[model samples]
Target: MSQRVPNILLEQLSDFINKEMGLFFSKERKLDLLRGVSLAAEEFGFSDTEMCINWLLSSPLKKRQIEVLARYLTIGETYFFREARIIQALEREILPAIVEKRRNTSRMIRIWSAGCCSGEEPYSIAILLSRIIPDIESWKIVVLGTDINVDFLDKAQRGIYREWSFRNTPFWLREKYFIKTDDGAYEILPQIKRLVSFSYLNLVQQESPEYLNLQGFDIILCRNVLMYFSQPQVLSVINRFYQSLNDKGWLIVGSSEASHVLFPQFRTVNFPGAIVFQKDLSMEVSRAENVLFDMEIDDLIPATTTNYDFSALLNADNSIEEEAEDEDEFTKAVNFYEQGKYKLAAELFKTLLNDPVFADNPQVYILLAKSYANTGDLKHALHWCNKGVKKYRLEFQLYQLQAEIYQEMGKLDKALDALKNVIYLEPDSFAAYFIMGNLSKQLGKTKEAKKCFENAEKLLRLKERDDVLKEFDGITAGRMIHVIESMKSMESPG
Candidate 1:
């Protein structure tokens, strides 16, 4: 019989996996870690799980070995139109904005699906564009799908899928865009298949990402993938993504994974049931050309001022100008926020709110709230968020931010109400339903909690079985259902 993997061995493997693969396996997940390692052991030419564990611990794993391990550690199950609301937002709001903006100019659109598995996502993007763009033939469209798993990439390249892969897809999608093969698998039509290019990418291990021309993308989708990574690795990957996108480009993550705290560099754009990160290259450019603000100040200062000592007066004016230029409040607050100086950021952002130039800007309100929240000042965070909501009643992100603050404060009822407003504004939001379910359970509202969980399950049923729910940190829909069932069973009396 194959020996059972020991606890000590499992602990060592967990650390090694986190260090080498940037995938974390906490003590609670050691069994999962052990199981994955055991599966990888067979591929590594070892039958005994304990022996494979020791071997993996003793030496640095090769690229191929890590790739094999990744196949087991990461969930690859995905289907067309997996996150229906997110896809709808892209098709209705985002793509139209990009197309109209570029129609008169470059007529080019580039989308990257980072961690794309089995080609479903990028292919869906291509298909969506094909449906929307009237002159798609004239536009230079690049939809790139990249994954670390070679097997996944090979399957993606083949463009064939069984009925299982069509779960939650529209009835007409397959008939309209695919051809039935003799082997009984549906193959993506040539036109759609040719629109997407599949490539191998190890996001964690890539020393240089430029080889893939990983820049100037109009949209990057890295959904449900970062939850597996260590916190530092997540931050590193997110920052790299920030650099890769074009000005005003969008980053669509799993709704549950969306957080202003995590993506402070990007501006939040909320669509119905979705929150996407946008690269504001204009802000970076403004910071870069802050010297231009100096020219404005120079022009404002009188060329000749009435004074007894003209040269001395000019020197004093020069000192004053230098001070004003150095103290650009908005730019300094953004820099402080980026540097993680929440107190200083809050102070600076507060200063901007009083200025006529920034008083009405919703971004200022959001940033101020985030700065306060980061510093553990929930009261101030909620206050600013409420102020933002009052000013921009239609802005759903403000309500979302308010809900987070209430949850952090352990005010479950308030949090539930805040999330209700979020749902009212964005009825199809999976995150709202999932989070509200947890909050309802915490408040001992068993029936309400069940209703919420059932609502969430209905949304999950529309996804592939193995597809991870982003907000729950790598928990698959099937696993989450099991959790809900277990909770119910435990709560039931004999």
Candidate 2:
């Protein structure tokens, strides 16, 4: 075991991994890295005295082991609500403001937590959503947790953690969300299991996350994860994170992690010990990775209020519509919404609402709600949501939409209630379980969050391969379990 991996061997290992598994590990900490390589050899029955060190050099998987070595070398050290200030800012300032700003489009919020390890961080985010917004129970909320280590992800899914993981957990969360296992480990309860999702992801893997490309999330938390990487690696990871978030979205990182302020695309904002980097989301991701230019903040905001009112779209006038025969109602409304013409959509909805004969239909109410939501007027959007809920009593779609609006408004409690109603109304929907997991995570219910993610993954896997990929936003490029690269170098026992 003392036969150390040489400097050239480390670079060779990295190149080998890149060829075999499409992942790369830089060489800044080569000395600290061989330990992982040695461990992997032991794990895979390759750590043999007779295997001869040179034999280890030829195997293709030797490279793959390097990536896995990184995972084993790096420990994901975090817990439920490890930092209070960032979560507080998310609840009070970020979500609500974003909601007010995005009322004109579909109410969708996707978030990602990388290097989620044993699931505490994403679960922490879920807990915040549950506590801050009651109506979030029904949103199209997507919280994805990814890590390179498959074994760790398995533990993360189990949601049973030791006390050390909850070192900074608040008393209220401890009381409400988890139950102590027979062995004294704290396990997540079912209430927190319905809102989050997890998968295996390699940060240095050359491919753009297939699952992420389909979703331009509102927030991404890469936190302490990037600190382990070299400067080139850091820049690469940050660029990827930028591509991952939507316009005007935010990225939260550990307070002491390397200062990303020098990175051109992001603006640093201090939040207690945690610092948030606001993504200049004015531009969409370019097809080429070469477009690494700094982002530009656009002045194209739809509204200034912190909370949105969707009912406002009902003000669009119908007077001018009769003269335009070529423009159909749905088309005109959709066009205006897409073009950021909230006022035009509002006028159209207004005309429709003014017509007492056609205004009260549940369909119209749904349209009106969407219009207001598109225009960044969530209050009015909620108003329309309530109307649709009443008109189509027992339908969960309206509730789901409402829940998303509440999440955006940072009303985790309300959002949870909506999701609860959805689950109660349709036990087999499975989507409710996903939302529930996120809410629980926001409440610092790690165990619950993991369960929810597991449930969602189970449901997704039950479907056909294509269907599963479609359901999870088309992340079909790799396996759910990614074994790192460095570990593959050891000689296999004959």
Candidate 3:
């Protein structure tokens, strides 16, 4: 019989796995961890779990060794049209918009399914796109499915699935899209299968050649993948996704991850039963507001004033100039922020909080919070975010800011609670879902993390091109998708 793993050794092994793969196996999961280690030991030619643990800790694991361990750790649980609402939204709203936008342009649509297990999601996208476009042959339609698991990618490329894969699928869809095999498996029709291609991609390695080459996608779907990642790893992958997208490109993460904090750069678009993020064309405000305001001030305050009482005239001009400068303070604060003078920017933003002109502007609070955060004043940043939430109860952005502040302070529960408010306001907030997933994982609530990741994936699958994200600091939709897939592998079976 194999020797049992010691408690201390088990904890050490768990920590090693968590650090390497961003997977957390708590004390509750000790038995499962032991089993996985035992299997890994057998596969790696070690005599026992202890040997396996020592080897894993001491040696740099080869790519093939990592892949083997991943196979044991990850579970592939997916189906065609897993989330039907996303597909319906894509067919009805997102796709039409992309088609119209591209009609005069390239007339091409490129979609990527990052962490596509067994090829179901990408194939579904291809099938749906073909159904919508009559002239699909004339258009450049690229659907690529990628995963870290070579086994899953190989299975996806084979284009075969069992009955379990179609549990929720309509009969007509199965009949239309697939043919029954003699061995009780269903083989996807060649026409639909040809539309999608599968490959290996590890989202964690952002600097990899495969990741660098992935760019200019019109739509990218990454679902149920990020719940397993470390926060820094998640952030790195998200940044890559931002870089991968074309301007106005759509990034679909799981619906649960629809929070503005995760994709602060992406614009949020709400459709019936779906929420998606779009990379917006960078809008350049002409600086005309400041210029026009300045011009008006110049016009009002004449260079030479030789009228009635000089002192009275000067007082009147000073009052007018003060009022105008007050209005211009907002612009000045923003410029300070751009110039990296966070403290001054924060003070200016705070000053405007009480101004009647800025009272109703939620952006003021967001900027104030950002300024504080930039200055490492997390406490003040959190305070401003909460104040904004109280004042503008319906604005999800305030809650998102609060979550960020809480996260920065290492108050994970507070961050999770803040994200709950963001989700309450915008159910499709992918960033919130992603953050919640991370928080839940940290708390050892594996199932909850999985569900949150799944929700984010569903929402992300319906996005289109030319859609602007409401806010995405640096993270991209593509990277979030990869995170979701990476997390999916680590989720405990329900």
Candidate 4:
């Protein structure tokens, strides 16, 4: 007979799982959480569900306990070419561009499947690359499949799959790439398996030193993984993804996770029934080309014969071109900022201020200040932030940026005041409330922090479950609510 877990205990387990594994379970999914825990209890040597729950909540979890729990809790439900649209996009558009770019130069390609479950997705990628690239033996290819679950990695390393894993795919793929074992399970061909390597990685622990080698990727497929993370964690992971890619590299996220708000810095490329983000190259070269063409056309005209002041006309044309050039420079500066070249980014952002056209732009102020803040030039960062706030008083983002600079300077009171100004501008901003909550907690204002957290939760509840809160860095409303609940539970006295 199965023993049921108590509601209160289930809530605590939900919080624990979310914090430890970056997986979320809302109130509606408590029964699912209970069932997973119930099944994992036997493996953990617990006789009953209640005892297992108590053991988990009793003390800090050991790594062995976490591994056992991960085996049961995480879902490994994926098939070869699971999302056909993404595969098609890769085959037709994305990969061809990459191959064309590297065909004559590096002859190297790297791809990472961040949440690869049971080895299917990365193998599918290898198979696709083999079909697309000629003389494949000459190319240096690496397709990395990483997951938090060791069991999944072990299964992936074996390169075996059942018929269920081949659902919706053509029979020829099996015949071409897989061999039938004695037990009737399909084993991937040794050649296809050779192209891929499996490893254990927890996305939440990306900041740890072990993951330092996770850079210089050509394409990263993190489909359906970010949905499980809390909003702030999702933002952090996305920012890291931006850093992971080579210049002009691609990022393919799940359809549900596709939001311009989440990936604002990346260029959104729309294909047939699919959308992917790319780290675009700077537009400076193209603008300079345009400038050269304009000058060439001016050179063709007779300079002395024309009654018109062609010089002034050229200056007018140059003025328009200069604005476009500044915008391109801004884009390049943002790329530098994302790449952590903070000093270079700061220098470029300062030049944008010489032109009032770009200076009046509010984002210039925000990024400029952030560039300085990132470089540890807090004084200059605060100065720009305060100037931005003065010029764009109604812009809540400036005040928010100012608050961050103040917080970095350890001026907690001023930071709180800036946040208050943000609330005044946008009364229903849940993110503001959330940030204020953390800031309050930092100041040791426990009661005020609780009130702020509650307010943030209230605002989140009014949004649709799947609506990505852009202010919260693309976390869905439901996940934020769960995150708040988890924080409250941890703060509560037992």
Best by TM-score: 1
lDDT of 3 by residue, 1-494 (tens): 27577789888887777666656565655776788778878889988778778789886555676677777776676677655446656766788889888878898888999889888889988878877787887888889998877889889999989987775566666777889999988898988887888877768766557776799998888875654555555556666776788888888776545544555556767543345778776744344233332221011111111011111111221112223355488888776664446798899999998899987899899888877776667788788888989999999878877776776577878878888988999997765776687677766776887788788767765554223222332224543454455446434332
TM-score of 2: 0.51
Cα RMSD, model 3: 19.3
On residues 439-470, what C-alpha lDDT tens digit does candidate 1 reach at each position? 77666787887787678667777788677665
Off by over 4 Å in 2: 1-32, 49-71, 99-105, 208-214, 258-260, 272-274, 282-494
Report how far off residue 200 is in candidate 1 (Å).
1.6
Q: Estimate each model's TM-score.
A: 0.62, 0.51, 0.58, 0.56
Between candidates 3 and 4, the one scoring higher on lDDT is: 4
Q: Pick the candidate with the highest lDDT.
A: 4
- Cα distance off (Å), candidate 4, residue 270: 0.8
Cα lDDT of model 1 overall?
Answer: 0.72
Clashing pairs for model 1 are none
The digit string of per-residue lDDT tens for model 2 on 173-211 reads 666678888898888766565778888777766463534
C-alpha-based local distance difference test score of model 3: 0.69
What does the lDDT read for residue 94 in candidate 1? 92
Instruction: Report every candidate's CA lDDT.
Output: 0.72, 0.58, 0.69, 0.74
Worst lDDT run of 10 residues, candidate 2, spans 296-305
